[model samples]
Target: MRLALAQLNPVVGDLRGNAERILAAARSASAEGATLLLTPELSLWGYPPRDLLLQPARLALQSAVLDGLVEQLDGLCSLLVGVALPCDDDRAPGLYNGIALVDQGGWRGVARKQLLPSYDVFDERRYFRPGDGPCLLTLEEGERLGLTICEDLWVEDALQRERLAGPDPIAALVEAKPDLLINLAASPFDPSKPALRRQLAGQAARRLNCPVVYLNQVGGNDELVFDGSSLVVAPDGSTLLELPACREAVQVWDSSGPQQATAPLSQTPCREELLLRALVLGVRDYAGKCGFQRALLGLSGGIDSALVAVIAAAALGPENISALLMPSPWSSSGSINDATALANRLNIKTHTLPIQGLMQGFDTSLTPALGQQPQGVTAENLQSRIRGTLLMAVANQQGQLLLTTGNKSELAVGYCTLYGDMNGGLAVIGDLYKTSVFALCDWIDSPEARNCREDLGLPQQGELVGEAIRRKPPSAELRPDQKDSDSLPDYSELDPLLKGLIQERTTPQALVAAGHDIPLVERVQRLLQRAEFKRRQAAPLLKVSPQAFGSGWRLPIAAGGLCSAGPD
Candidate 1:
């Protein structure tokens, strides 16, 4: 049997549009002489449709959409479409995250997801009830197929220790001894996930002693980005085919074919390149899906905004991106010139809106209300607000999506200004640490990034970010002679500390014992906790790392459990 894998991008809650996407892929697959078509998890409503699954109107529309799919697939081919199945029992969760097989005859539920992950960004338990056991579908030719959803195939106790209590779906399915196993997944992207998924699939294929097909969703939805590296693993645990990462693709696999040697996984791009592609895809999908053709950002000539500009130009065409240089009284000439140079290199439009006048006006107006002029951090924040207001005005006037330019390190320590520099529809690099920002910029300017830049439609020639911007000392330029180092520790030192605290969940003493200064660790810890309020109000940021400040990093702003010195 020839099976077509539809690694597609779906818009959440757009039942009509998502159904149309599936139908289009099915027609193409049918033309390619494929007998069966497989789609990712929840392709009809998009993955993690969240509360949309609970809406009465959406529940009512589900049946109509399924009927439409059946009509489209009639006489063309058999399609396994991921959809939400409403339960008849009122005591149940009211729905099952399930797959329905639609053939020329009719459609019916074939399988439902058994393992509902509640950890991290996933809240599946809130919407879906677990399936009882393995579901086997028999074709007209007497070919038996075993079906599983995203988490069903992930039964590795060592890898998923928290989920060990759940019944092993793969083991249960293996007992049925079907000819083939197919998994529909909407797994989100993490740098380490692709390799981990490959290991899991190989293990499953070996255990079942049958060919395994894994179909994954591709696209960015809000903060999550899904990399669709769909694949077909032979019965001997050899990979016959591997789809492209961070892209939408379709490929056909023959179940009768001999088991081929596994392809080398070394061909996967290095960590930096993979991350760049993910971010670019995230920005593109978020902007396009949210209905923004154009994007704009405040260009400070510093590394953060420069990197965001490059990403924006690559995501939306350079012509579609605009940069506003809102220099304040303290802004340096070199900073302004550097910003202009970077914009010129990227071929993006730029407008100068010096904020010195706005700063003075604000000082005069607020003198009476404050009984004195705003100074120190307040004064510095006022400058950021002025620049932010101008960026917003330009973005609003031109109907462009504004991109925020803050990084993880600053955000962790509360170094960013809320509603001021934090104003944006999307935080493009909020998941990257300040040190990572520098490293990425360095790589972008180097020879290694040529192919990636060209592939992404960025300037492939010469240095795109340039040496001047990359070499300049990091500064916000909100005040004269100001540097990030004035208030915060060097990023090289701070980034590792933040990683230990945020990602590793290490305590103060533990960090100190690992060679960090006690006072500095405690101070940084306090800043991170105090800054939760600011992060709470910040724009939705693209998540690239294992632990990002958005959705996954759940912490209460008012809560207090500050680490203190111990007997050590």
Candidate 2:
């Protein structure tokens, strides 16, 4: 059988649009003489449609959308489209995450997702009820096809510690002894997930003793970015073909033909390149879906803003990006020059809005009300607020989306000001640690990134983030000669500490035992706890890490049980 995989992006809740995407792909596949087409899971309603699945009207629309897809597939190739099937039993949850087979005139359910994940970013058990057994589809050519959803094939993988307790879907399918195995998925992007997926598919192929076709979704939906690295693996656990990552693509594989030599399956991109592509895709989709044509950010000439400017320029065209040099009285001349030079390199427009005047005006107006001039942290935050307000006014007047430039290290310990540097419609790098911010910049300047940068249409020659800006000490420029290290621990020491606490969920004693300083670990713990309120109000950050500060990190603002070093 000639099968085509439609690795396309889908907008959540846009049933008609999603169906149109599927139909368009089906027509192309049919033109190419493909007998069957496979789509990503939840292609009709999009992945993690979340609460949208709860609406009665949406369920009604889904039925109509399915009927339309049946009509559209008439006289064309057979299609396996992902959808949510309503439950016939009242005792079960209202829906079953399933795939429908649409041939010439009719469609029927081929397989329901057996494994419903409930850990990390997934909460499938809240809405979907597991299927009781395996599903096998028989094609007109008399070939048996074993169907599985995203998590159904993940049970045997030891890396996924949060496996469901239901019957092993892969084991059940193996018992049926199908000729070919297929998995439809909407797996989100993580730097290491693609390799892990390849391993899982190889294991499944070896167990089933048949070629496995894996199709994954590609796009950014809310906090998730799906990297559609679909693959076809031979029964001997060798990859026959692997699709591109972080983009939409369609390709065909002839099961009857000889194995084709393609790129090495085990090769993965450098961590820096993988992360950069994910961020670019996330920014483009978020801005485009939110209906913003242009993006603007306060360019402080620091590492964070420079990196964000680079990503924004790449995501939205450089012409569609604008930067504001909101220099305070404490801002250095080198800072302004560095920002301007970077902006020139990226071919983006820049506006110089010195906030010293606004700073003085605000101090004068607030002195009488408070009986004292705002000083220290208050004064520092005032400068940030002035800059944020100016950027917001410009963004509002010009109808551009504002991007915040705070990184994970600063955000973890309350180093960022709320409604100031933290003010923006989207936080592009809020999940990146300060150390990661510097490393990514270094990678961008290195020869390894030249081809990737050029492919993304970013400035290819020389350094995109100049040497001067990168080598300088990290500072906010809100106060005179203020260094980040003067207030917080050095990022080299702090990033791992934060990672242990936040990502690893390590207690203070455990971190201290792991070579972190006792006093520093305790202080960092207190700071992280105190900063929960600030992070609560910050912009929605793009989640790249396994444990991002957004939806996954759910800590209470008023909690007092801090991670302790010992019996205090």
Candidate 3:
């Protein structure tokens, strides 16, 4: 059987657009002589529609669109498209995330999602009811195939800390022992997941002794970027076919013969390459979806702005990426040159607007009766606020989206300014740490840049070495001789402390007892809890970790009993 995996990107709630794309893929697959085409789970409505699943009107609209799809495509090929199905079961109108097999003639069979994953990014329990069984559907090759949606096969492990009904779907399906196993899914992107998905499927197929086809969705959705490295695994535990991550593709696999080696995909791009692509798509989709074109970023010579500039260039063409270098007296000459060098490397336009005059103007304007009693860091902060104001003015004039570059580690310790550096339409790497940011930049400048696909073009930071900047002490340079280390512990020390506190959910006293400095731990914990108010108002963050500081990790801002609380 020749199968086609429709690894495409879908826009959530764009019913017409999603349906049109799926129909187009079906026609394309037919041209390739593929008998059956499997699309990602929830391909019609887009995965994890969240609360949109609640409205009865919306589900009705989705069903109407599905009917239209069946009405339109009758002869091209068969499509196994995923969507939600409504039940009149009186036991609470159950909605199942299921797949509909529609041939040229009409609807074939509907297979509901048996496993409702309710962990991490998923809240299936809040919305969907679990499906009871699987389906053996007819394929053009005269084969009865077993069908399972994403979470169905991922049921080997307990969905929660608690256990549930039935054995793993894949194991149970092997007993029914259809000729082939077709799994539709919308597995999201994690940097480590592409390889893990390939390896997991290879092992599963080798154990099952049957060809396993996995289909995954690709594209950016709000806070998530789905890499569509969809795969086909042979029964002998080998990857027969693979598609590039974050790209839309229709991967074809023939299930009859022993797999032959074709051109292997380029090695996973360096960390910089991964970050660059992720950010580009992140910015592009965020702006494009929210209905904007141009993006404006404040370009300080510092690494954060430089990285955001690179990301903006890749996202909205160089012409669309505009930068304003608002340097204050504290800003160094090297910083200006670095920003200029970065703009040149990216081929984007740059504007140098000195903020010294602006800073003085603000200082003079505020000198009515405000005395300088506690004249320490607050005095230096005025310069940052002035720069931020200048950047906002330029952004407003050009009608561009402002991009803020403050990172996760800094934000964790209240190291950033609220109305100052925290202004932007999106916080690109707000969830990333300082160390990972530099590592990603190194990947971009390495020899591997030559191997990246020409279509998805990356940002080049030029022959202007990435390491010097990488190693140069991380500093805001807001004040003369100011460095990040002056106020906070080294990130080598702080990030691990943060991981222990946030990821491990450790308490302050417990953390100090476990090798953290008592004073530092107490200060860090207080700052973390106090900063909840700032984080609550911050822009949505891109989630790369199991836990993030934004909506993914919500804690109380004023509640005293946050530790091991019942309902955060």
Candidate 4:
């Protein structure tokens, strides 16, 4: 059987548009003489349709769209489209996340997703009831295809720790002795997930003694960015073909043909490249889907803002990206010059709106109310708020999307000001640590990032983020000669601790035992817990890590017991 995998991007809740996209892929596959075409999970409704799946009208519309697909694909080719099947048994969570087979005759649900993941950015169990049995689709050519959805194939305990308890779909498929196994997925990017996926597919292929096809959806859907690094693994546990990552692709594989040459396992790009692509895709899709043609950010000539500007330029074209240099009285000439030089390199427009006047004005207004001028943190935050207000006003006036530049480090400890530095429509790199911000900047300046820069349509030559901007000490520039170190631990020491506390969920005592300072660890833990409210109110950050502070991090804001119970 000639099988084609459609790694296409889908807009959430746009059933008709998604169906059309599926049809276009089907046409391309049919031209290649493919007998069957496989699409990603929830391709019609898009992944994480959320409450849209709860709507009665959208469910009815799904049926109509499927009917249209049946007619549209008639005699062309058999297409397996991912959809949410309505349950007739009147069950709670009245749908089954399933695959529908559409051909010349008609369309019907062929394979239902076995595992319903509820953790981390996914709430499938809220809407979908798990399928009870193994799904095997026997086609006209007598090709027995074992089918599963995204989370069904993630049963390996070695690769994942907190796995969902369910019947092993691969084990059930082994009993059926299927000719091929195909997993339709909407797996999001997590830096290391691509390699892990390949390994999982290889393991499953070896177990089933058949070629395994892993097809995934690609694009940004709110906080989640799907990296479509789809692949076909041979029975001997070797990858035959691997599709491109972070982009849409469609390729056909002939099962009857001779075994193709094994793709090298080590050809994967560096961590920096993968992360950069994911962020770029996230920003591009978020802005495009939200109907913003231009993007705006406060470029303070600091590392965080500078990196955001680079990504914004790459994602929304340099012409579409605009930066507002909102310098306070504390802002240095070197910082202003650096911001301007970086903007000039990227060809992005910039407007200097010095906020010294705004700061003085706020001080004047608050002095009578407070009986003195706001000093220290309050004064610093006033400067940020002024810049944020200016950026928002310009964004509203010019109809541009405002991108927040605060890194994960800032957001984690409440170093960022609420409605100030944290104000924006999307947090592009809010998942990146302050250290990661510097690392990515260094990579952009290095020669290794040249080809990747060219591919991203960024300035392909010479120091995109100049050494001056990158080498400068990390500072908010809200106060005179104020460094981030004055408020928080050095990023070199802090990010690792933050990673342990936030991502690894390590306790302060454990972190201290692991050689971190007890005082620093305890202080950081307290800050992390207390800053939950701020993170809750911050812009939706792009998720590139396994555990992000987005929808996945579900800690309570007012849990005094949890906060007080920290290490003594």
Location of the lowest summed lDDT over 10 successive residues in candidate 4 = 559-568
Indicate the residue-level lDDT of 481 in model 4. 80
TM-score of the candidate numbered 2? 0.97
Report the C-alpha lDDT of model 3 over 281-396, residue by residue, as the tens digit.
77787788777799888877777777777677768888888888887777778878878877877778988888777767766766675753224667676766766777788778
In model 3, what are the clashing residue pairs, if there are any? 74-104, 272-440
For 101-217, candidate 4 gives per-residue lDDT tens digits of 988888999999999998888888899999999999998879999999989999899887777998999999998999999999999998889989988898899899999999999
Model 4 bad stretches (over 4 Å): 262-266, 562-568
Give the TM-score of each candidate. 0.97, 0.97, 0.91, 0.98
- C-alpha-based local distance difference test score of model 3: 0.74
lDDT of 2 by residue, 1-568 (tens): 8999999999999999999999999999888999999999999889979889989999999888888888878767888999998899776467899999987778888899998988778888888998889889988889999999999988874756466788887788887888889999999887888888888898999899998899999888888889898999888878898888888988888888766544555456788998999999999999988899899998988999999999999999999999999887788999999999999999999989877778889989999998999988999989888888888899999999999999999999999998899999999999899999999999999999998999899978899999998999999977788898899988999999999989888878888778888889989999999999999999998888888988778899998867578645
Tens digit per residue, CA lDDT, model 1, 346-402 = 999998987778888999999999999998899999988887888888889889999
Residue pairs of candidate 2 with colliding backbone atoms: none
Error of 1 at 37 (Å): 0.7
Strongest candidate by TM-score:
4
Better of 1 and 3 by TM-score: 1
User: How high is the lDDT of residue 324 in model 1?
Assistant: 92
Q: How displaced is residue 342 in candidate 2, in Å?
A: 0.4
